[model samples]
Every structure is written in C-alpha cells, then in structure tokens.
Target chain A: MPNTDSILRFEKVTVAFGGDPAIEDVSFEIRAGESRVILGAAGSGKTVILKTSVGLLRPDSGRVFLFGQDITEMKEQDQFDLRARVGMLFQESALFDSLNIEENVAYPLLNQKAVNCPEDQVHARVEEALTFVELGHTLEKFPSELSGGMRRRVGIARANVTEPAMVIYDSPTAGLDPITANNIMALIVKERDVRHATTVMVTQRFQDGAIMARYKYDRATETLVAATPGDASIAGLKFLVMKQGRLVFEGTLAEMEQSKDPYISKFVLRN
Target chain B: MLDFLKSPVLAVQEFVFLTARTIRNLPVRPHYWRDILMQMDIIGVGSLPIVLLVGFFSGIVMALQMSRALQTYGAVSQTGPIVAITLVREMGPVLTSVVAAGRNAAGIASELGSMKVTEQIDAMRALGTDPIQKLVKPRLIATCVMLPCLTAIADFVGLLGGYFIGISLLNLTSAEYWTGAYRALEYDDVAQGLLKPFIYAIVISMVGCFYGLNTRGGTQGVGLATTQAVVSSIVWIFALNAIITKIFVSF
Candidate 1:
C-alpha cells in the first residue's frame, strides 16, 4: 500500500521567490496511509512542498500529482474539490482570530452550499475535534485567548475536521516545550492511526532520541524496544531531508541514521 | 510615464480577469451570502444618515441659492427645474458614489488585505476556494445593488430637504413647488442617474477587493490596501462620473 500508486507525486517540482530558486528540482512521493516528515532548516522549502501541492503557491516548473491527478493545471473549483482530500496546518495556528474556536472549525464547512448538516451534528464534530486536541471546553474562545500550545492543538483540530485523507503540518512542534511538542507529535501519530491518514510533516527536530520518542512502533506487536531509546517511534514513518528545496535523502528512520549523509548527520547531531 | 501607462493597462486587464474568475466562482464559494449581507449593511444601511443629511441640505441649499439668484432676474420660478435637474442628474449619483468610495471601499479593501496578511485567503485557496469569488463577488454585487438604493434614498431625502427650505424659507407654496418639481423631473434623467452608479459600484467594490486579494507585508500592507482601495475608487468614480455626465447632459 505504501508504494503502489503514490497518493502524492512530485516530479521535478521547483519554487522560487523573486526569480531566485528557494528550492529546485525537488521530487518525492508518498503513498496512501504513510506518514512522512520533511526535515530541513528555515529556508529549506519544506512548507513550499505542501503549499505547492495544495495550490497555495504554484510552481515555476514541474508537476504535482495527487491521487494520480495533475493538480497544477486544475481550476480553483476543481482545486477546491481536491481540497477535501488534503488539509494543511500553517506553522502558526492560522485560526481566524476574528472567529472563536467553534466557528473557526465550522469555517470551512460554512463555505459549501449544502451544509444541510444539523447544528447538533456540526456542533458535535466541532467539540469532537476540539476534544481530540484537548480544547473541548473552549468553543467560544478566540484564537487570541488561547496559549501557543493550545492554538496548535486547535489548528490541528480544524485541519482534521474535514476528515481529509492527507494533512500537511508545518512545524507543529516549533515553539512548544518538550512536553507540549511531544503531545502534538503524539496527536499527529494518533490521527494517522485513527483516520489512517497520509501525513506530510515539516520539523527541524532530528535527534535519535527525539526521533524514536516521536512514534510508538506497531512493528507486529513489538511496539518499542527497551534496549534502545529515541525521541521518535513513529510506526512506518518515512523521513526526507531537503536542502535548498532539493531532495537530499529519502529513507526510513533507521536508514537515515545509518546513511553517511553529511546534511542528515549535521541536522541529526545538532543540539 | 511609459511604465506607468503600461502598468495601469496591465492592472486593468488583471482586474478584469480576476473579476471574471471571481464571478465565475460564485456558485462554489460558501459564506458569500454572509459577505454580501455584511457589505450591504456597510454600504447601504450604515451610510443612510450621512446620505440623507447631505441630500437634504444640498437640496435646500440648491433651492435657496437658485431661487435667490433667479429672483434677481425675475425668474425665481426657474429654481424648481434647476434644482430638480441637478439633483436627479449629478448630485444624487456622483455624491452617493463618492460617499461609497470613502466608506465601503475602505472597508472591503482592509477586510481583504488583513485576510491576506494572515493567510486566511491562502487558507481558502488551499481549501480549493477562489478568493475573489469567496471574498470579492459578494461585495461587488452588494455595491452595485446598494448604490441604486442609496441614490434613491438620497433623491427622496434631498427632495424633502428642498421642500423644507422652499416652504419655510422661500415662502413657495407646497403645492406649487411639488407640482413644479414633478413637472420638471423626466424619466430619462432619473434612469440615467441610477445607471451611472453601477460603474462606480464596480470601481469601488472591485478595486477594494483587488487590493485586498493582493495584500502582503502584514499590517502596513493592509493599511496601504485600504487607502489604495478608497483612493483608486474615488478617482475612478469621478472619472466615470465626468464621462457619464457629458453623455447625459448632451442628451
């Protein structure tokens, strides 16, 4: 299932700002039900990958294929039709501070014509997503009222409210404490397991301990090995390292650890 | 100068395409009705007091000044036709547009521009939603529709203002003034005035929404967008008003 037909396919995708390439000739593929994390520095075009795939920014060159469809040439309405298949969370929560939590979750649902959903059902889903993120009781609260960690949770809730097949997260753990970041990482893992969603994650965290700690292995009943400790244990989690918008490495977590890739080594060993 | 002319033409074409895209997108975007209603509230209902106040005073002042000036030549009765003609043809339409450009244009541009700064527009696009259709069309539709209603309101209020001054100050009998006003007003004059604002409506709403959709650079960008929306709209309104007035008056 991981490699049959890529859920998302990028072939020679390139993005530039002001005629200078931020990333160039980047290509990668993620299949259905697989979770991938892109590791890179600040200007490394990690978010650009998700932004281009979702049509927030168009690529200067190359193709973006989702579910085997070329999304680059699709009309906005078609893109919108495709939107239900993909959800993205900005590095910041990106909640409408003007709207409170419930309305923020309901924002996307309100944009359709036949939101003939019962208020109770919609309300219930709002609460459910909020509860999933542990922000259930703050439905009327504004984004301004939420803490940084809480806002990230709310952002995750809103992105998942549509039950999208794929969720793109930009630095979900960037500004939080170690404990809070772990909670968000745990939620990211939980969401994939529960929804069986394909996720693309961008993070700078790459320590072996942190990498192993981030996931709980469902390796045929061997969830974790007491002999080894790490910050990531994401089951079936695929990792990609990008440099200046180009693909630097692609492999499993263990493979990344073993490869003598200097960029990966430099990123992984950083304090 | 060459660069300036080139950009304006390119900008106009860009606006035209975006406008079409926005209109074409109306059926897909949700919250359109809400944005439309909010625009109506801002453009039509919110501006009522000022419009009424201006219309009334302008009407009264027109009657007074016209009557006095005409009376010096023993043609005071001509005030009726003169005030009626000016109100129906120019003041009612142009003033209404100017007011709209100041108020609703600023509001639409800033609302959109802030959304841009915050990535709410990006969020919409990511959701496969068209920003113009989701954000621009409703406001544009609301503007064109609301302007006529506002103009009509201005007409009624200005006439009443004329009535107040004419009867109380000029000592013109109510019957004589009303009869003369009705006699002087023509179908084409009123029709032409109502029609002129539609273009201004386009200028106001479209320009405002355009600035918003293209907003970047955070808070300063939004503020600049708001200012640009109002300034561009007012300029366009006056320019179009001049062209329309020439066509109407010649008729």
Candidate 2:
C-alpha cells in the first residue's frame, strides 16, 4: 500500500555494490511518530535500506524522500541540514574512539550550528542524554573501555543527542547475548516513548523485533513495561520482513505471527 | 591483467578528486581548529627525534666522505662548502620527508583506515559533520605546515654535524670550515630546500587520506593502506623532488 503521508519514503530504490545487487526495487514508507522494525536473515540488505533512508547510501535508481524532499540529488550542504533531523545508530556502534562518552554524546549538539548555546548547556544536554541511556557514570570512559552493550547505549545517546525527528537503528543488537540484546531493546523503547521520535530499526532477531512491537516505557514507574494485550498503541508499530533484497511481508507483529507464508512461518518458528 | 592497466588511472582520478575536495573544504565554515592543533603536535613534535637524528648523521657522514675526496684534489678546505650545499639543497629536505613518509603517512593511513572500517567516519557524516573537513583538512594543514619545519630543523642540525665532522674528523681548521659553508649557501639554495618539502607534504598527506578513506575489506585492508600510503608517498617524494628541483634550477 502506498503511504502518501510518509515522513520517509523509498520508491523503487535499487542499490548495487560492484555490480551485485544489495537491495533491489525496495519501496517503503514510514510516517512521523511511527516505529518500524525491519526483520530479515543475515545478508538480506536490511542495513542497506536503513543507510539509504539516512542518505549514507544513495540508491542506484529511483528516489528517496526525507520529509518530502528527494535527497538523492540534494546539494551537500542541504543534505547536511536534512541529515540533522535524522539520527542513525550503526551496527558496530561507531563511536569515535578518540573521544570519551561525554564528547561523543556532545558531538551532534556542537556541530549543528543552529544549536549554538553555552558550553554549560551543552554539558547539561550531554549529561541528560547519557542519563537517558542509563550510562551516565561512564561519561569519561572511552569507547574502548565500555562493554558491547555499554557502547551501544552510548551510540544511542549520541544519535538522539539533538532530539532528531527520525532515528535509524541498524542491527543495534546483532552480536550480543540475548540478555544484553533485551536490555538494549528496552532502552530503545524507552527513548521512543519519551521522545515520540520516529524510528526505523533493522534487526535479524525476530524475538527482538517482537519485543519492540509489544512494549512501551511507562514514565510514571520509570520502567519498560509491556503493553497490555490487544492494546491500540501497539498497533502504531509496523514490521517489514525482507528476503533476498525484497520485502516479502509488511504488517503488524500479530499479522506476522499469523502469516501463512511458509518462509514467514519458518522465521516465526526459528526466532 | 585488465585491472592492472585501469588501476593506476583510477587511483590518480581518486587522488585528484580527494585533493580538490579537501582544499574546497578548507575555506568553508566549521573549521576544526582543535583537531588541527592535535595533528600538529603529532606530526611535528612527535617526528622531531627521528628527523634530528637522521639529519645530524647524514651531515657527519657527508663531511667525512667529502673531505677525503677533496684532499685528493688538494682542495680539502672546500669540504665545508660541498657538505653544506649538498645538505641544504638536496639531502636535508628529501631525507626528512622520506622519514616522515615512513612514519607519519603510515600512521595517518592506519588511523583513518581504522576509522573507516569501524564506520566512525560514516557516523560522522550521519551526525552532519563533513569527514573531509573534520578529518582530512586538519591533517593536510598539519602535515604541510609541519614537514617544512622538520626539514628546517634537519638542515640546521645537519650543518652543525658537518661542522663537528670537518673540525674533528677531517682535522680542518674551524675558520676554513665555517667560511666555506657560509659562502656556498645562496638564497636560492635555501629557498629550494624549504620549497621542495612543502610540495612533498601535500603529496604525502593527500595520498594517505585518499587511500585511508577508500579503505575496504577490514583490518587487513587497513594494513594494506598503511603500506600503500608509505610506499606511494615515498615514490611521490622522489618524483616531486626531481621535478621541483628542475623547476627551481631552471628559474
């Protein structure tokens, strides 16, 4: 179904690397204040689609529109301005090794000129962001000193430091133990609830995708609380399942669980 | 075989584009002054010991070798002039740049290459920071500013080393050595010494950044980039040396 109210849209986008296709004719649209979880097996080009949405990778054919503007051919300076509204969490957590966590979180605030405020304000914002991730005590620690889970949290903090309208998470929990993966997902849900920010998350783990679909952060108790069964808020979240660089299934997690397609059912069983 | 022929042309194209892009970013807003200072400390201050040691030894060796040859012609007093002119015009800048190419170029390549592999560079872009301006421009400025300073240090220490060698090893009088050395050095020779390394500095830094930013494969790719950065930088250093020397001499 075509989404005319898309805050992010990809129309017939095809991306290739060195003559081999990574994502082919992929089309998807994400509305503002909505959360999307893209699930696929390894080598399924989920990350490629996420990158294209953020303008890190340009589509070989067709157009990518961010906030109704075609970024495929946007001027670089304009692109930078456009990118300021979007935040991306890389699969590897991509924190600058040279910078400690405080500097890393403060990077976006410092660079985006419109946010030029006093140094103390920047520091307070950085501290607030780190606190949001529950890693506030690790502010002075470099990325090398953090565990994989801690690094991912710092990546989350840095990504949302500017309170961007759209956030892209590319396999945020790919290589971690299940417990750590759940912890990261909870933080992601917490941020989504608190900021009401639009999110596009790519993950290979079906359980993790389901967890995001089924959870909410309750600010009253300050905890990631599971949504009541059959809740309407859960309906705002969507899922896209990819196989061989094409979207095979797109719907709610309930639809995914009841999907009659053999491939989708197999993923349901395995995950 | 097909790839072999196309590779160098493609590499040159990449280098040219990177050079132009980095220069274009230099005058733009959002200058990374702190990064530039950090690079200066790394490239200039860090490479000092090696540059000084090489410069001093090259001068002493040249004086010792040239003195014997001069004695054969009954022109032993000319040792200081020959050593000074060679060190000032040829040996000092070239040797220091070669040392820098080996140490600093490889360091820059590996550092940037690792950042590329780890996706920190891409993260920079996603965060609205231009990697060329934030990463490459500061490095280019630092290297271009620092290499000449290192060369000047090398040249001065080299002359002092020659003085010591002339007076102590060759048994030449201090007056004869100092007089000949000062007389042989022309303004053009000093200008050539400083000018050549400035050009070489651009070449080395750009080549390093090009290969570094273009790195792929992973850790293995970073290693390959490091080797390529040093080898290519050294090659360009020699090539530019000959070309710049020709241009200066012709003028």
Candidate 3:
C-alpha cells in the first residue's frame, strides 16, 4: 500500500484573478508514492491548480501543504527551497532556448543549488538524464534546432534531473503524434515506478490517465506491463475529473466508467 | 476625467513597485554574475560603433551650424568653445541615451516578452529561479555601468569631430580650437555629462524590463511591448533630462 502520509494537500483553495475565480474551493490530496491524474477540458483551470501547488500563484483563501509543511505562508526564499523538490513540465515543453540540450537538462540542478558537483559531474549527470529521455546524442544541440518531440523530451530530462519528490506534468502529451505521445507517457510512467515518486499529471485526454494507472514498469523486460487482476499498484493511480474549475468526479477508471453522472459518462466515452 | 488620470497614476505605481523589487533582489543571494557579464558585452561593446557614428556626425553638424551663427556676429573663432560646451553638457549624453533607448531597450523587451509568451519565465519560476534576479538585475546593472562609459566615449569622439570640422571648414587654427575647447570645460560640466547618462540608463533598463515582464497575448504582444519600451524609455529620458538639468542649474 502507498504511504498514507500526504505529499500534497489543497484545502478549500480559492484562486482568483481580477475578482474572477479561476479555481474555486478546490480540495484534494495525494498520498506519498501515489499518482493523481487531474482530468479537465480546455480552460478548466488545471494549470492554475498546478501553479498554485508550487506557490507560483497564491490562492485568495485556503491553504496548500507540501511535504506536510504549509507553503501558503512561507517566505519567497523558503518557497524557493520547497519548489526545488517539486518538478514541473509545462504544456509548451518550455525548454530554455538560450541553452543547449545538456545545459537545459542541468538548469534546474544548477539554478536551484539542488546539487553540488564539479564540472565533470554536472556533465555526467546531464548526459545521464538525456540518455534516460533517449536524447543523449543531441546534448550539444539548441532547443530551436530540435523537433517538437525532442524538445518535449529535453523538458522531461530537465524536470527529472532534480529527482523531485513530487512531479507535476501539465499536458505532457498535448500536441504530439500518437506514437510520440505514447513514448512520452511511457517515459513518465517509468520515472514514477523507478523512483516511486508521487505525481500529479493534468491532461485533457482520459486515455492518458488510464494508461498511467493501469501499467507497471517491468525491469526484466524493460517495458510497461499491464496490471493483472487485483493488482495493488492499480490503486496507486487515482483520477479527478474537473469541469469549469471544479472537481466533478473522483475515483478509479472502473468506477468512473460506471458512474451514473451524465458528465462523467459523456467524458469517459468521448471521441 | 477621473478615469483618464487613474491609468497614468497606476502605471507610475507599478513602475515604482518594480523598481523596489529589483533593488531588493540586487543584494539577495544566487547572483547571476555570468549573465551580468554577457549583458555588459551586449550593451557596452556591441553598441560602441553606433555610439561613435552618432556622436561624430552630431559634432560635425553642431560645429557647422554654430560657426555659421558666430560668423554673422563676427565671432567665428568662438565656434570651438560653443561646440565643445554643447556636446559635453547636453548632446553627448542625450544622443547616446536616445540610441540606447532604441537599441538595447527594444532588444531587452522583445527577448523577455518572447520568453514570457513561450512560458520560459514561468518555467524558471517553477525551477526555483527568480526571474528578477536572473533576468532583470543583470541587465539593470549592465546598463547602469555601461551607459556612463559609453557617454564618455561619445563625448571624446564628438570633441574630436568638432575639432576636425572647426579646423577644416571654419578655418580656425588647430591650437586655437584645442585651447578654446579645453578652457570651456569645468568640473560641473563634466559631472553633469556623466550624471545624465547614468540616470538615463536607469530609465531605459527599468522601462524595458517593466514592459517585458508584463506582456500578454502572443507575438503581437511582444511587438507592442518592444514599441512601448522604446517609446516610454525615450519619453522618460527627455523628461528626466529636463528635471536633472534644472537641478544642476540650481546647484
């Protein structure tokens, strides 16, 4: 069973901009080693919630706890320290264009002072991260020179380089081709399983969430194996369906499919 | 109308707030010295040739016009002192700042506005990096340090150009032109020359960063920000120059 200790908790958080609420009274918690997928359509404030979790945006009311510490009241410098342990993959794969692939991957580590290493060690670590994302050969290349899929992989490498305790992925496969999307999803799942890291992935597609919830990384075959009947690891993946900045449904895929709620039914069987 | 006055007031308030935040981040840790050096090269070294060209031409034009006016008064020999004083006290710093406002200010705004639209700025914040420290302060310090140096270079070049024009066109002797120019310079004139560019530097850097960081929409927004940065920085340069000149006169 995943640890009951919560890695992230948002209690009745209300975030608004210019007197209009983006996400209102949203509350959810993810336990350690558990991955929670936030399913939302366009403009449903999924990105706002993720930004609030990292203290990039402050809520109008309510509290956010990270690793059991209240970050709502933390100082900016203290928040910086907390954010170092939380990795985020932006929707646009926001790789630093001014930096080469290796430097982009090493950015979080060097900028956050999360790792203290000599030049060679930093190089080795960057190479290892890019290798994990299957882009080791592109280390010297600039992000502008890379394809969209390659840039996304570089972003993943950067996010995972810090080995964050909690990883937040905002539409990790939003605009990719099916094959590239699947590859990115597989990479995400592999990182989660290998590190047992708690993850919060927000996606518009229901299938992406189901894929993460129902697969386990097999070391022997080096692949994502489907979970068998009564697999406990399946419980580690939970889903939260959001509509217009509010959570509409929360449960397993089976439960979501069987739900009588018209919205959930329509969403679960969407084209 | 009340609404008409409120927008400018709000703009001033936001500008003041940004300046305060930038100052607070200046002494804070995690200083990006490497970015500072890069900005120095971009602002100082990259803009040197343009500054020289602008200064040289302005000096020649000023000498030609002043010699004509003085010739009517039967005082063509006074062109050297008049041109030297005008270039040192006013034209050198003002023209250099105008060029920088168009070049560096627009460049900073377009670059940062593009980053903002592309989500790189948000990514930096997510990665525990303060955009103010990493992005703004380096450019801020670089502009401040380089503007004064650039102005000095421009002043020297302008004086040389004026000397060449005075000896060639006005038929003034080389020794007479040099003596008049040297005699026209005072401690206060030199101080004011250096002081104005330094002040203009702050205006240019802060306006660029302010508009850049506040950009929205997309590529269109970046274009708007670049235009606004240059326009606003130039406005502040001229307005602040008036204020500073008034204060210097009183002193």
Candidates 1 onward: DockQ, in order: 0.50, 0.84, 0.84
Candidate 3 residue lDDT tens string, B17-118 = 988999888899878999999999999999999999999998899998998889899998888788888988899999999999999999999999999999
Candidate 1 regions with alpha-carbon error over 4 angstroms: A1-4, A109-120, A175-179, A205-213, A217-235, A254-264, B1-6, B25-31
Query: Which RMSD values do the candidates have, in order?
Result: 3.7, 1.7, 1.9
Give per-residue lDDT, candidate 1, residue A124.
Answer: 83
What residue runs in model 2 are displaced by over 4 Å at the alpha carbon?
A1-5, A229-232, B1-3
| lDDT (0 to 1) per candidate | 0.79, 0.89, 0.89
lDDT (tens digit, per residue) of candidate 2 on A1-271: 3355577988989999988889998887888788899999888899899888878898899899988888987766678877888888999999999999999999889887655656779999999999988988998999999999999999999889888998899899989998999899998888888898998899988888888888888989998778986654465789999998888889988899999999999998998
Give the Å error, residue B143, model 2: 0.9
User: What interface RMSD do all candidates show, one decimal each?
Assistant: 1.8, 0.9, 0.8
Candidate 3 lDDT over A1-271, as tens digits, reads 2124888899989889889888988988888887888998898889999999988889899899888888887876678877888888999999888998888888887888654546667888888889988999998899999988888888888888878899999999999999999999999988888887888999998889888878877879999999775765566788898888887787887888899998888888992
lDDT of 3 at A188: 91
Q: Look at candidate 3 and give me any clashing residue pairs.
A: none
- Clash count for each candidate, listed in order shown: 19, 0, 0
Ranking by DockQ: 2, 3, 1
Expressed as tens digits, the lDDT of each residue in A129-168 for candidate 1 is 8898788999999998989899899889988887888898
Q: Candidate 1: DockQ? A: 0.50
